[model samples]
Target: MPSDSALPQEDLAVRLRDGDADALAAVYERHSRLVHTLALRALGNHHDAEDVTQQVFVAAWRGRHNLDPGQGPLAAWLVGITRHAVADLLAQRARTVRNLHAVAAQPAEPATASLDGAVTDRVVVAHALASLGEPRATILKLAFAEEQTHEEIARRLDLPLGTVKSHIRRGLLQLRENIRGVRADAS
Candidate 1:
């Protein structure tokens, strides 16, 4: 049997079946930043995001036994957890808004500030990039952070030229979608 270090998460799950705190810690370390970013985007408040991040990991750890190796990478599972946690925060916020609006004498027009929620939007973008697995994540970071060309990315990752282009295109699309959603929610 290979050591946990030598095996993928599927095998790690087996080693953790009976209960290994280390496995849970490793998973948290690997994916927590991604989860935190997702939560921050959803909630738009750092304090709330931090609390929700803890909840997301707790849920994942408690449900670790149900993980399916064939389905996907553990990161995807964590992303799902992050999404749900954010949704929960959104729902709660909506409830509070509804309650507050009911008592307000005059509803202020929703602020149409030009720079509305830009910070939160950036945090969301940072989180989304962090969530992406390596090669994809590394490719994106290089493409965006350094304004590297597709050829440069290929050279850095030693991947095929086509693969580099595909990654950048796909990553940009995803980032656009994610940022749009975050902005919409923030407003």
Candidate 2:
């Protein structure tokens, strides 16, 4: 009997349908390059293309019983599957972008939750600010609570202007993460 690679495409498709693992390997070796190339062309990123290539083969193996040799070439069916995989990846990327944008579009106020008569929200924000530690917590308090300018804070803290600015930046980020975590848990 011929090796899997030596068999005709239709015979390989049939063998693959019958659950022959060697046929799956043979199918991959013949078509992976084509799949990867198509994916790369559509995605324009080598890493994403490689991921889509792997997704195609995995999907192909999982759906092997669906192959119908009489309909067309196995290569063509693989091409169709590749197109679908690429579309799914692109859609996922779009959703991620939209989610990121939604997060960014939130109100610029430091804490919307603070505007209410809720001491709980104020306590949460204070706890988040305190958790920042040392110069960061102090820097944030001096900047926001005292309404001091960055230059004023630098002069008062005896730190470099840049160091004061760095502390404030990092402190705000950590506080945001902490507060967001609290909000998520509350909801």
Candidate 3:
């Protein structure tokens, strides 16, 4: 039997369009390394790159019906998906950073003593967020600053619901520790 790699691109495209998991696997085998390299170069981190690579293939498979064998090679189509995924990752990272800064630097109310205390608390929370990194920082910002529900955060971030929840839980714990330390140091 001919290996999947030997099969014509048109045949593979048709197989993929028909929802053949094997064809998707073959397509992934042929192009996943390219996707990973592109993601890694764009994201500059191994975990995010790997996540984008998986997301690229999953997005391609989910949208297989739209794949046109006549337009171009499957690899090119996958590359396009990878580009979108990378763009999304970067955009999300930027938004997370912005939210963290906003939360950290938010002005306190006009009340004198309360304003000082509120500003100090925001600063502590922001410091903790900056230390959490990536999705964790992002998740916490969405949950706390934006007051988004866990499901809303997961949907917006394209993360699993459980992952979003876990990040929020851990972030809150870390934030508490950091705040405690900050208070201890002040005293």
For model 3, what is the C-alpha lDDT against the true structure?
0.85
Compute each candidate's TM-score over C-alphas.
0.50, 0.62, 0.62
Tell me the lDDT of model 3 at 157. Answer: 91
In terms of lDDT, which candidate is stronger, 2 or 3?
2
Candidate 3: tens digits of C-alpha lDDT, residues 1-187? 6777778888988889889999899988888899999999988987678888989988998999999898998888989999999998788778767867987898865666677687777788889789888989989888878999877998999987657856886787787787778789989
lDDT of 2 by residue, 54-104 (tens): 889889989988999889999999999999999988887797578669879
Q: Which one wins by lDDT: 1 or 3? A: 3
Q: Global lDDT for candidate 2?
A: 0.87
- Pairs of residues clashing in candidate 1: none
Clash total of candidate 2? 0
lDDT values for all models: 0.74, 0.87, 0.85
Candidate 1: worst-modelled 10 consecutive residues by lDDT: 113-122
RMSD of each: 16.3, 13.5, 10.4
lDDT of 1 by residue, 53-82 (tens): 888878877887787766887778888888
Q: Where is model 2 more than 4 Å wrong at Cα?
A: 111-187
TM-score of 2: 0.62
